[model samples]
Target: MNNISNKIKLRREQLNFSQEYIAEHLGISQPAYVKIEKGVTKLDFERLLKISEILEIDINELLEKQYIVNNFKNSDSSTAIGMVENLHQENQKTNELLIQTLFSQISDLKEENKRLISILEKLSSNK
Candidate 1:
């Protein structure tokens, strides 16, 4: 459907399963799976329960963030985005570490490349 929607779809797809496969397990028709994937039809209780069980997801995931249930709240799309962004930003220090590592790799590769170039030049000169 959408990127956010597709993220959910991709999660289902990550197990190398198909919509029909999931529908069969859910005891629903293939068309129903299509409808759910397209976001045209709301997920029924039975399907939701099955989805939660199969996907190992929380039921609150389907609802809006403001709707708290059982002392847990759902995260809306914006909230999810913000949370992810926050997490990534929190990893900026880690990125600095990765950058140093990448620089070291680049330095190693440069030395290897120089060695290879020297060998190639020597071979070409002999030829």
Candidate 2:
């Protein structure tokens, strides 16, 4: 499956969202939605438009380098070679998790990191 589709599927599952719900939101049939999620059918402009609205995510997030980097970083590694292996493993694990939506996880992590940065900045200013 295409990596993009894999990601879409993962995010959808993570949210415990049903395909029917997404399809309803997209105003598409469940089979059509499944085809989109499976990457069997290319995402036309109309579908992309609907997906962005329903997922409440900017189209950019679907193609962000930051997301790619974060996923790679979380895949534990002992060395460069090990890092590659870990990433492969992590990708496989993610595929297995029935992850429906990553926005929650990614958003929470971002908020936490933002809070940490603010604290660090404050501490630095104290000096």
CA RMSD, predictions in order = 15.5, 15.2
Top candidate, metric TM-score: 2
Write one digit per residue (lDDT tens) for candidate 2, span 8-101.
6777787788989998987779998898888787664446656766766676555432334565565545554675665576456544442334
Clashing pairs for model 2 are 10-99, 11-100, 11-101, 12-100, 12-101, 13-99, 13-100, 14-99, 14-100, 14-101
Worst 10 residues of 1 by lDDT: 63-72
Which candidate should be chosen as best, given lDDT against the real structure? 2
TM-scores of all candidate predictions against the true structure? 0.41, 0.47
Error of 1 at 23 (Å): 0.7
What pairs collide in candidate 1? Answer: none
